[model samples]
Target: MMALRLRAQHRGFHSRRPSRARDVARVGRVNPPAIRVVAIAAACILGLTAATFPADEVHWTITGQNSVTVDWRGGDAEVRYGTTQALDRRVEAVAPEPLPFSSRGPFREAKITGLDQNTLYYYSIGGGPLHTFRTPPPRGGSGFTFYVQGDIGGSLDWKHVAECQALIAEGRPDFVLCVGDLTYGNSVGQHAVDTHFNDVMRWSLDAAYMPAWGNHEWDKPRSDDLRNYKGRFDLPNPQSSPADRRYPYTGGGEDWYWFDYGNVRFVAYPDPWSGAWADWAQRAEEVMAEAEDDTAITFIVTFGHRPAFSSGEHEGEPELQGFLGTLRARNPKLVLNLNGHSHDYERTYPQGGVVHVTAGTGGSNLEEESGSGCPWRGGCPEPPWSAFRAMHHVAVRLHVENDRIEGTVYCGPAGGGGSNTNDIACAQGSVIDSFTIYPYGLKPGAPKPPSEEEEEAQAKKPAPGR
Candidate 1:
C-alpha cells in the first residue's frame, strides 16, 4: 500500500493542470437551466481567477536589519506594502516574473528594502490582505524571536507535524530556520518534496523559511536532486561574481554564504559530500576567522545536516568530528550548531564552547537504538558534553532579546498515536532544555581588554590536543 501511494505521488509529477473554461462550457450545454447555473458558476470562477490568487503560505524574513523579505508559495509574487494597514500608502516594492505552472515546481521570493528600523509596517501581496511585521532595530538594541525544526518530510500520519505547526502559528516568530532533512526524497520521488512544501504551506502561512542542506537533499544525484532543491528556494549569495546565474559558487560552494540580521550573523553551510568533508571543515574555519569581532557580526550560528554526536543507528561520522574541531577553533561567539538526521530530538551543552541541538524528529519514522557498539551510541556514561537528550518528536523555539539569545525545545507526542505521554516512544509537549547565548566581547559592565584566557579559549585548539 505504501509503495502504491509512492507510485501515485510520483505519477503526479507528470500531471498538468487542465483548462477549466472548456470543461465548464462542455458541461453547460446539457440543459438550459444547467447552462444558466454553469454560466453563473463560470462567472464566479472567472472572477476568482481575475482577483489575484490568494498568495498561499505568505511568509516574511529579515533580509537585513532594516530590510524584510516577503515570500509565498505560489501566485503573482508582488507586494503592495505601506506604513499603514490601509495599504493606501504605497512604499518600495518588487515583483518577480510570472512563474510557469508545471510539476517541476518553483518557489517565488522577493526582498523589500528601505524599511524603517524598529518600526512596524503593514504589507500585502497583490493587493490582497494586509499583514504586519516589525523590523529589527539598526543597532540590534533589543532582541528578536524565530523558529527552527528539521526532518519534516511531509508525513501525513505524523500528528507531531500538526502540533509543531500549531505551535508556530501561536508563536508568530520572525522567521523559521530548518537545519536539514526537510523532505525525505530518498526511496520516494520529487513529489515528496512537493508534498513537504504543501504541508509546510499549510502551517507556515506567515513565516520566512531559511534552510540548510540535508542528506535526503542529496539522496539522488547532484543533477537530479540538486535541481529540485535549487529551483524551489531563493537564498542569499551576496558574493556571487556573476549575478543572475544559478548556484553562485563561492569558496564553500554557492549555497554557503554569510548574512547579518540585527546583531546576529548567520552562516549557512552546505552538507559535506563527495569526500569534500575536510575541505568544508577548513572553509568553515576560515569563514569564522574572518568575521568581525565588534561590527557586522555579534553572534555566529552554524547549521548543517549530519551531526557530530548522535546516538541514532547511523551514529556520528569521523569527518564531522574534524569539521567540529576546526569550527571550535575560530570561536566567534559560536552560539548554536543545529542539525537533523537522528529522527529524534537531542540538545548538547557548550561542547568545546559551542552549543549543539539535533531536531531530526520532524514527521519522519523514528529509528530505535540498534544497540550497536558505535562510540557515540549506547548512552554516554557521563553525557559527553550533552546537556539534554530525548527520542520524542519536537522542534525548537528561539527568542532573541537584546544581547541575549534564548532557545526552548518544544517536544510533542511520539509514535503514530495522538495520546500525550512522557515516554520516549510517546509524543508529548514539554520543555526538554533551554540555554542563553551572549554576544562576543561584551559581558555586561567589565570593559576589560582581551585576556590570554579569553584568547586561548576562543582560538582553535591544536589538532593533537583536540
Candidate 2:
C-alpha cells in the first residue's frame, strides 16, 4: 500500500559556473549606467537579506507511543537531543514527502525509538537552528501532565489561540492533545488547513501537538480527509493482521491509534465523519476489553470530533447518539470524552457511570444554544446523569497521580470566575468543575462496579442531540 511504502527521492545538484572579472568588465562596458545598476542591485540584495532574517517560525509535533515521532515544518528536519542543554548528539532523519495545499501544508515527521521509559529527552527538530520537543514517558511510569483542547481554527477568534499558548506555557505540559476541528475547513477550502497550523505555530512555543480528526477536515471526501490528516501528521499505522498489507491495525483506521504515557492509555479514534464509526465502535470495544487485563491501564480516555452527549448547537445527530451509546456500552471505565465540533464547552456524567466531558470551545466562537433537550440547556430541568454543564470557552486538564486521576475543566479567561454557570460568556478559564477517579481497588468503599441493571439504565437514558 502507498501508506506503508517508504519512497525517498534525491534531487541531483548541478552547479553553475562562477562569473569572472572579464565577464563583469564586459557587462559594465556594455551598460550605460553600470555603477548605478550595481548600486541598485546591492540595495535590493540588502533589502532581501533584511526581510529574510526575521526570527524563523518553527513547527514540530510529537506522535507514537513508546517510540516518539517528531516532525518540523519550514526548515530541514533534524534532531540534536540529549538530557542537557549542550545537546551533545545529533541525528539526521528523512523529511516527509511534500503534501499539496501550501508550502507548509504537510509538515515532516520522524520516529525516534530505543529510548528509556519515564526519562526525559530534550530534542531539537530541524537539526539545531530551531524547533524542539520533549519526549513523553511510556504508560504506568512516573506521573505527568498534558494539555487538552479542541475546535481551534485559524479564522474567528485568534485570541483564543493566544490563550491556549499561554496556557501551554504556564502548564508546560509534556504534550498537547488537540481534540479536533483544528482548521475551519468545513466552510473554507484546503488552504485553511495550512492557515490553521500557521496560527498554531505562531502561538505554540515548544509544546508537542497531537491532533485528532474533526468533521471540518472532511471538506472533499472521506479519503481526502485521511490523506490530508496522514500527510500532515506522523502517526502509527499498526501493520494490519499478519496477512493484510493494505489495512493497518491502527484503532480508527486512518488516524486511529493507541499510546501509553505515565499510567494512562490514550486511544485516539476517528469521529464518525467518514461514516466509519460503527466499524470503529467494534474495534474500540475490543481494544478496551483487552486493556482490562492490564491493571496499569487506570485511565481510559478517548478523543474524537463529536461528543457522546452535548448541550451545544449541533447536539441532535442520531448517528452521534448511537456512537456514544455503543462506546459507553463497550468501555465502562471511559473516564473522559474529548471532542470539538460544537464550538462550546460542556461536561456530562453517565446516567450510571462514565464521565462525558466536551472541550469543543478552543478559540472557535461560542455556538448558540440549540434549545434541544440535552443537559446543557435548561430543558432537562435536572438531568439525572449530568454532574456539570456549561456553554463557554474552555479546555480539560488531566493530572494522573500514582493512585488517583484528577481532572479539572478550565473555562476561558473571559468567564466570570472559576465557577460553573449557564452563561457562556462568563464561563471562560473558570474552573467550572473538578473531579477525581481512584483506581478500582485502591480506595475503600469506592462505588461498586455497575450491575447489569445499572448498565441497562444508562443505555436507556436520552442521548445528547442537536
Candidate 3:
C-alpha cells in the first residue's frame, strides 16, 4: 500500500516555554477548509509517488482534563508533538498489556500528560504525517461542540457509515461521543474493529474519541468475552471496573468512565447486558451526585447502548428508565440521556425533566416503530413520549453553551437497502431535527409556571366566547 506524508510547512522552533495565544491561533487553522486543501494536495502527491510507512489505524483518546492517549499500529515506538507545526516535543510509545484469552493486539499507546489545557498540539508517529489535536479546556469551559451516534460500522453498510463519517469530518467537532456498538465486534470480529479504527483516523484526526460499550462489544454465550473491543481503544478508569458475577468477566473498562468537558459532566454508564446492571446503575448515580456538587458542572449527560424509552422495534428497558427517571426527577442538572440499540432516530419531549435521544440510526438495519404503548417509568400516553421518530441513518451534533444546549440531527443515505421504507427521505445528508434546551430552567425572558392558586383562578375563568 502507498503511504502519505505531510511535511511541516513552518520550520521555526520555539523554546520549552509555550505561548497560549500563538498555539491557540495555530490550532484554529486546523479547520475543515485548511484540511481539505491539505488533503487535496496530498492526493495529488500520492498519485505521483509512494512511500512505505507501516503505521495504521491512528486515533486519539481523551483520558483526562489535560491528557490524551494516542494509539496506532505498526509504528516506531516514538511520538513527536509540540505546540507549533515544527513538532519539537517527543515521547516514547509502548504496546498495551495483553489480555488473557482475548485478541492479541499490537496496539501501541502513548499518553501525553501535563499538557496545557484547551491548547492544540501537533504530533506524528515515526516520522509520519503531521496530525493535530486539541486538549479540552478547564472543566467550566462551555463553547465546544461534539457529535454523538451509536450502532455504527458493518461490512454491508459501508456506504451509510462513509456518509456519516463525511458529515463528522465536515463539522470538525472537538470530539465524538460514541454511545456504543462502535464496530459490531460480535458480528464482524477483529477485521471490523480494525477497519473502523482506520476509517475514524481521518475525521478524528483533530478530535478526541470517547466511547461507551454496546452489547455487540461482548460476544455472549459463545466465549462471553470482549475480544478485540478490549484490546483496542484506551479508555479512562479501567481499574474502577465493577466485578461481574457471571463469567468472571470485566469488559467494563471503557463503559464505566466519566470526564468533564467544558461545563458538561459526560458519563458513560455500563451497557445493560453487563450482568451487574443494578450495581452499575448505582455507580452512575453516584457519579451524577458528585457532578451535582461541583459548581463548575452546569449539565450532566449520560449515555449507553440500550435505550430506556424508545419508539423503535425493540422493547423499552424499564430498568434503565427507572434509574434515569430518578436522576432526572431529583437533579435539575441532568439534561440529556443518549442511547442506541433500537436502530432508528427518536427524540423524546423532555420526559421527566430530561430529553432522551435514541440515535441508533448509524449504519445498521433500520427498525420501524413498534406500535406498543409508550414506556416511561411513571407511565406515558400511547403515541409515546417521542416527539420525532424516523427510519433514516442519522447523528446528532450538540452545541453546548453556558445557558442552553442546542442540537441538530443530520440525516444520511438510506440505512438499509437504499430505499425510503419510512416517510423521511433516506437520500442525501441534511438536517432533519433541531432543538434547544435550557439546562438551568426556562430560557431567558420565558414565562414561569403559574402557582396553584393562580392556576385555579385562571381555570375558573371562562373563555371570551363563553
Q: Compare the candidates by TM-score and give the number of the best one.
A: 3
Report the Cα lDDT for residue 450, model 1. 44
lDDT of each: 0.55, 0.54, 0.65
- C-alpha RMSD between model 3 and the true structure: 13.0
| Of 1 and 3, the candidate ranking higher by lDDT | 3
The local lDDT score (0 to 100) that residue 2 gets in candidate 1 is 4
**Which portions of model 3 show Cα errors greater than 4 Å?**
1-52, 98-105, 155-157, 221-224, 238-241, 245-248, 369-382, 415-420, 445-466
Residue-level lDDT tens digits of model 2 in 44-76: 677543222222323445455445665444444
Error of 1 at 139 (Å): 3.3
Candidate 1: tens digits of C-alpha lDDT, residues 30-117: 1224675686488567764322334453445556656766544545545666666565544333332333122322245667677776
lDDT of 1: 0.55
- Superposed model 2: Cα runs more than 4 Å off: 1-65, 97-100, 104-106, 126-132, 155-157, 189-191, 202-205, 221-224, 237-253, 273-275, 316-331, 370-384, 413-430, 440-444, 447-466
Candidate 1: where are CA atoms >4 Å away? 1-53, 88-107, 155-159, 222-224, 238-254, 275-286, 290-292, 370-383, 416-428, 438-466
Which clashing pairs does model 3 show? Answer: none
Ten contiguous residues with the weakest lDDT in model 1: 1-10
What's the lDDT for candidate 3? 0.65
lDDT of 3 by residue, 204-258 (tens): 6667778777666653435335545555567765424554555334543554778
